[model samples]
Target: MTSEAEGRFHIVDVSSITSGSQRATLRTDDGVRIEAVYEPYTRGVTDTAVVLAHGFTGSADRPSVRRAAKALAEHAAVVTFSFRGHGRSGGRSTVGDREVLDLAAAVRWARERGHARVVTVGFSMGGSIVLRHAALERDTGGHTDAVAAISAPARWYYRGTPSMRRVHWVITHPMGRLVGRYGLGTRIDNRDWDPVPLSPVEAVPMIAPTPLLIVHGDRDPYFPVDHPRMLAAAGECELWLERGMGHAENAVGEELLGRLGDWLTRR
Candidate 1:
């Protein structure tokens, strides 16, 4: 909320879209450019806003992100932004480390726009960032009304599952980063965390008394049920476990998205 520069449209296709939404580029306090879109909630709703953070390799324009945003917009204003390095933003990704700054910037934007209450909802890597961001924001005396973290990992360096191992390879291997940069449009950092950042479970304790919802799927290949259990225990919040849900945004259906929007509205 302290400092940000509004940016104009850089892509014609996105600019030509006919939705009743506002698009702008946001500058993070650390100086990263974040591509974002804001969709005001329907008139009769209360003054609450939801900020969405997408998973790794996903952007604000992704169909899944837009779908979730549209669903949430039925109840509250929605702000969806691509984390630096993932979309048209300028910066290499440290995975979830500096991404917290991206979420913080978006949350501040929501507050600045006159939303009395702000709820952060994140998916996958984004989910972890939301948990950490809310905790970090509160530690600095900032306000975050509520948070919903879905399909997030409790701890880092987990490779118990084969899919996760492959993802690790994609993120850590040289050729993988090449493919990520070119093929997937994702730029990942090749450096290690010198001073380890707070794990998702570690960050949960600090978000106390602020509403928190932990949602995970039993069938997620990236993370087992234990991840959500660990977060639920640490945060002492409600956990919604879907029976056959897979992972992140892909696994999220429209019905669930609406329910999550309702959940945030009620909070």
Candidate 2:
């Protein structure tokens, strides 16, 4: 569905839009209307764009680090949008696999707008989504300057690791089991969503040279700290560990902000 505003462009009247915000909807290959926020730089620096995505059970305007969008727009154009069913975007979530299409849709949107250089910044589950989609972006002959993921899991098949299982039970204790029991086909809440056909770790190896940065907390409870290390070890990408940081919390830290800024500034 299109927005009510003129020309399908509506300004979001939220704090998230400090300077300004414009809306656009991309129709995915699966016929889903994916909603995206176009945060263009006001200084005519339109060549660069960052596609920001949120974690599972998170919103397009994820309160976690919405400011990052505003921060990035000052540098380049940024697009912070939702996966299907996660926010204003339409359709059901197919875990992170099918959601790759959502990321591709947003990338295409940026490219069409004359953004020759684009990067993706995903939070949590969104991290995994960005990783999966980055490969597709490369395969399609698109230009993705960089890809960064925060607190991402290298493997969602979290079945046997003792600590992994415990926390998994806590988060999904009330509802996750039910979703799993029904064999729910890789929905957003389903941890097994979009198992990557190959492990997420396997996907990591392909992210390098395209400029992949894996940002993880030293003490992320959801996924083991070693997971990111394993990811780093398996791939040629940069693994940036945030000391005393855990998962989404790192997004708001000064160190993270600085590192992110530096990374963006790099070629």
Candidate 3:
């Protein structure tokens, strides 16, 4: 949060352009322009690519997402982009609904760049969107080799969220109202989408056969450690529950690169 630009964006120049990294604009169907970072030669000679999807209110420039991208780049081409209404991507946010579409576009974009094996990594709400996107794509005949959900709130909000008053957490966060006011998203739309039905619990079933890795911080205040377990149980997914870790603590430290590197390499 060191820098908050007009677009709720920030960037960490971790690598040089000479590193063969390129930044470009990815146009979405809704006309919002998403900022994308492409790091080729990650896998050296693999036809695979990894897409890193940051959580709610997160952008590609966020240190966590950037680091994940760089880490995975060691295994394959890595692409990280911002969700609409977040960062430089178009219009206001649509919660996770339209964000699913954004992931789809990014995947296709990566495929065109020579990625025959596509892997998606989503954190928090980004995980939710990844599940929904992969599900929708499957229903439509598109294919994804693997999809991972990390520390996602895979249950419905507005139900029994005594913790953090999860429903109100979404409804009252100032930024939430701000996005609604700007027509970037809608408050009522959340009511229409049940977390349980739309959550990893529901989405995990469809991802079976395709590889999945569910990572979670055992001490996560927002999502239970068992969350990842449940997500994995639904499909043939591997589970990684970090002891004493909470939420997205995976974004930092040596473990970050090692864990993500291993995951992308497996894909």
Candidate 4:
């Protein structure tokens, strides 16, 4: 599991009890500092590691993210990290564009921890990141064995829903950015994508042979069912349309988490 990237990880906490949970700081390839936590399997022994990526404004220490990680730990070890600009991480959020580097750093860290297989599970903005990371980092040491994207957008600049429209305002307006910073505790970069990075739909096809799962809620307000449908069609992957689910980490429940854990285990 060791690689050159392993040198970039600096463990800040080493108190490994039965949970094998520890805190560390990771340096992305681009040099952004990221906060991460590693939690070992809760029940049984397994070599697989699940790298959990949280949605926009969410961080490694978020309650929802922590719960999801704990639930998934029942199947295998889980690695959760705060994307740059969120939580205690350094750098501004480029939305989903450069976030791939953050995920790549986390994946590399998971591998360095001696995991035989690494599975990436993302929610919302994180979902988009995992798809793009799985595609773009395939050749790099950050490759993921499997991927699951939940409540992700198929395309960029999508304002189809009111929630998404508000999101656009939050990303594009100064006042919205102020609210995001003070109210949401999320610092967003003011620069627009000079050349828009790969969209989730476009990235999905490139993740072939690597198992992919598209999970979306039928009643999601940010992205409609068509988003997941587009991803499934492009990648020809497994699609799970949760009936009553709403969106992202907030909507995820124990049952769905268990199912996701099972999917990661079987993969």
Off by over 4 Å in 3: 1-18, 139-142, 158-167, 170-176, 179-197, 249-252
lDDT of 2: 0.70
RMSD of 1: 3.5
Residues 125-207 of candidate 3: C-alpha lDDT, one tens digit per residue: 78888787777676442356788777776664523336546535555577656554454333323334433345667877877
What does candidate 1's lDDT look like per residue over 1-267, in tens digits? 122343422312243432556766777888888887888786665689899989989999898998888889888999899898888888988899999988887887787777888899999999999999988898442357889999999999999999888889879999999988998899999999878899999999999888999999999999999999999988668899998899999899988888899888898
Q: How many clashes in candidate 3?
A: 5
Candidate models: Cα lDDT each? 0.86, 0.70, 0.68, 0.91
Q: What TM-score, computed on C-alpha atoms, does each candidate reach?
A: 0.92, 0.80, 0.79, 0.95
Clashing pairs in 2: none
* Each prediction's number of clashing residue pairs: 0, 0, 5, 0
- Give the distance in Å from residue 205's predicted Cα in candidate 4 to where it truly belongs: 0.9
* The candidate that achieves the highest TM-score relative to the unseen native structure: 4
Q: By the lDDT metric, which is better: model 1 or model 2?
A: 1
Candidate 2 residues lying further than 4 Å off, grouped into runs, are 1-16, 42-44, 141-143, 159-196, 249-251
Candidate 1 worst ten-residue window by lDDT: 8-17
Query: Which candidate leads in lDDT?
Result: 4
Which regions in candidate 4 have their CA more than 4 angstroms from the true location?
Answer: 1-6, 14-19
Sorted by TM-score, highest first, which candidate order results?
Answer: 4, 1, 2, 3
List the lowest-lDDT window of 10 residues for candidate 2. 180-189
Expressed as tens digits, the lDDT of each residue in 1-267 for candidate 2 is 224553323434343455566667677777888777787785676577888877765655665546777666656778888788666777766656777878887887788777877888888778888887776667673446788888888887575556557546634564654553344322344445333455568788777678888888877767768778887898778888877776663345754665675586464
